[model samples]
Every structure is written in C-alpha cells, then in structure tokens.
Target: MRQPTLYLPHGAGPCFFMDWEPPDTWARHRAFLENLPATLPERPRALLVISAHWEAPQFTVQKHPAPPLVFDYSGFPPHTYQLTWPAPGAPLLAEQVAGLLQAAGLACGFDERRGFDHGVFVPLKLAFPEADIPCVQLSLRADLDPAAHLAAGKALMPLRDEGVLILGSGNSYHNMQVMLRAWQSGALTTHGLDFDAWLTETVTQADAVERERCLIAWSSAPGAREAAPREEHLIPLLVVAGAGGNAPGAKIFEDRVLGAVQSAFRFG
Candidate 1:
C-alpha cells in the first residue's frame, strides 16, 4: 500500500492542545484528530513533517535524538510556553534526507539545535498524543515559489517509500487578512467561503494532471491572493502534492473555521 501523506490546515498556535470545553473550534479540531489514526494506513516507521514555521535559506532537517522546544509563537497564555510534544527525533533519517537533497544537487542545511515549532507540535500532539513514533521536521526555504517548492518536495520523495509519513502541516484558507478579520468579527466572511469552495472543487476533481496544474497555479485560484496573501501555508501543500505525483489525493478533513476558513486534504 502507498503510505499516505497529509497537508493539514493546522489551526492557530496551540489550538490543538486546548480541550473540548470552551465551545470553540478546538473541539472540532480534536475530533478530526481522534478519527485520523484509524483512517490512516498502518502507522509509518516515522513521520516527516514539513512545517511552515521552520523556513531556512534552503532545505534544513532537525538532527537530534531528543529535540528541544522552539516556542515560536507569542502573546498566548503562559502555559502555552510550557507545552511539549516530546516525540523522539530522527537524526539518522535527518542525515538521510540531507544526503538526498545533496545528491539531488539542492542546497541543504542542518540544525541539531532546532526543536518542535507549533507548526509541528500543535497538530502532532493531537494526531499522535502518545509521541512514541520518531518524528523529523524538514524546514521550508525562504522561497515561497510553487515550482521551487515542488522540486524541493520531489527531492525527498525517496523517503516516502522507506516508511516515512510525510506531512505538510499548514493551512489552506490561510488568509492572514481573514484570520485577523475572523478574530475581530468572530464570523466567517464571503471571501473565506468562496475560496474554500474553489479549493475543494480543484482538489476533488479526480484528474491528476489537472490537480498538478492547479497546484502550480494556486496563487491564481479564486480569492487565492486574498486567501494566502502569504504563500507559506499553501507551499506546504505543494510538498504533499509533489509527493503524490500521479496519485489522486484523498480528502482527509475539509472543514470550515469561524465558518469560513477551508482547513482540508490528505494525499498519498
């Protein structure tokens, strides 16, 4: 069986760690996770996360058996700073990924000092609370160009066959313009809903060629500029889609946030 790879629209910082009580989006977030383990193919030997937070000048890998905390976000509750997902780090696989990038003639770097960023820990803590599986995070490059990112992902393609669950953890309808708007208005707006619909139709079309084309031209999608304004969240999707290649992506979880954001998709 082809191991599955996910491109999840992880909610804002530390949202996944919150419980079901406050009647916010976190409850739904947790539920999506509760059902994910069973939905995935038998667990991979390790998980390779392409987090939006860890961007470098080029591709970089975390190389350490036990990683530390990065606390990349700020202004949240103080307890948020103390949170730790504690998944074992895969320095061996990290070296392997680095080697692959070098072999592919791409600029690659490493940081044994790096640790879990919320782009990694937040959704991961929910998806694998046990933290038993070894995890490796590949940082994004400063370049947000779609074609460049696709090549970066293709370089890591070999790892997929070696039982690494490559996950692109970022948002789909990540309109920072809308994120702040949602926070203030406390409701989904027209642009969010429209962009989300366009995204669903584009991914669910069942045409490999078309999906690939759409991803390359994603910035042109309806409300695309407004939705992504910054392409980091969307770039993560390119990694997963590039890994999928000719395969059709499985729709993992496509849902709304604040009734507007399109948090969606999983691909093989």
Candidate 2:
C-alpha cells in the first residue's frame, strides 16, 4: 500500500518537552502528534522528513548510519539541549532520495555529518517515541522556491509505494514576532487567521491543478507574507501538495496556538 504524506506543525522550540505557565496550552497539538502513529495505515519501512530547520544551497540528504541529535533551538531548558531521539539513520533511503532528486533535475548532495534537527526530531519523538523507525532528513533549498520543492516531491512520489512515509516538517503560521505579539495581547491576529483559512481552502477544496497553481503563487494569498516573513515553513506544504498527486488532502489537525491558527494535512 502507498504510504501517506504529511505536513505537520513542529510547534515552537521544545514546546512538548517543557511546561508553560498555561500548562495545557499545547495539549491539543501534543495529543494530535502522540496519536499520529495510530492514524497511519501501517508502519512505514522508513521515514523521510523535509525539515524547515535545515536549508542548504542544494538539496542535501543525511546519510550517517547513526545520526546524532541536533539541538537546533536555543534558550530552552537545560534538559532540552540534552534531549535525544536515538532513531537509526536510513542511508539506503537517503541514496534513493538523492537519485530521485537527480532524476527530477534537481541538484542533490549528501551530508554524512548532519543529524536530526528539531523540526525532524521533535515531531518524530512525539509520534514514534520508541525511536524504532529508520529516519532520514532532507534539507530545504536555500532559495526556498515552491515550484522547485514541489518538483522534488513529485520525483520522490515513488517512495510512497515502497512504504516510505514522506513528511514535510514545518509550522502553518510561523511568524514569531507577530505570533508573540498576539500571544501577549491574548487575541488572535486577523492576518494569521486569513492566511491559515486561505491555505486550508487551497489544499482541501481546490482541485489538483488549481492547488498546484495557487501554491506556486502562494505569496499572493491573504496574509501569506505576514504569516511567513520567510517562506521556509510554508514551502514544505508545496512539496507535500505536489506529492499528493490526484489524491485529496485532508486537514488532519487545526488549532489556535499563541493566537494563530495552525494546521496539518495528510495526502494519500
């Protein structure tokens, strides 16, 4: 059976590992991630995550057999930096991913030293806490072009048939400055809500062709640029959307976080 492609929100740095004043603020998001494995049709042979935390000049694959934990976030509790998800690396899948990207005419590179960054480890830890699955990390392109990432994903679509879960790890609404302001004010921001609504409509309602077109030109969506001053977080959705092919996307998770609406999607 073909595995599902996911676009998940790896929430604010170390949110799951630590407690906040409002201890239950992240309860819904945490529950969604913790229950992710049960929602999958089956255990994937291996997992491939496109991490917003990593951006290279070209598409890069992590090929280390025993990848280290990358504590990419800062100013977290002392224990957070010491956190680890000891999942084994998927070198074979990494090479296959490289070949797929090359076949797509996208430049590909390999990094033997790179490890699982926050974007990959955080959500994976929540979903598969046992750390039994082999995982690989793919870096986002430094240019952050939606079409390029989408093409890359289209090339990797074959992996789904091979039981590899391809996931795009990013947040839906990722403007820290704006999100923080809304959090402090205890109110949701209109721009963030508008952008989130537009995104939901584009993926769940639009046909494949229109979805691709809107995503390629995503910056024009209401509150898009405001929601993501930098496109790294939003660009991952384009990749997953492309891999979706004719399969419909369902909004699997949606909630208000720090006064911004965040969502996740699954494509099969």
CA lDDT, every model vs. true structure? 0.78, 0.89
TM-score of each prediction: 0.92, 0.97
**Model 2: lowest-lDDT 10 consecutive positions:** 182-191
Candidate 2 per-residue lDDT, tens place, 76-159, comes to 899998888999998999999999999889999999999999998998899999999999999999999989998998998999
**Over the stretch 1-268, how does candidate 1's per-residue lDDT look in tens digits?**
4577778877877876554233666676678876777876788799998988878988899997898778888777788888878999998999998898788787888988898888888888888889999998998888877877777677777777788888998887666666666667766454566667777777666887787788788877778887877889888988877776666776667666654565667766
Query: Candidate 1 — which pairs collide?
Result: none
lDDT of 1 at 42: 82
Which portions of model 2 show Cα errors greater than 4 Å?
A: 188-191
What is residue 224's positional error in candidate 2, in angstroms?
A: 0.6
Provide C-alpha RMSD values for all models, in order: 2.1, 1.2
Model 1 scores a C-alpha lDDT of: 0.78
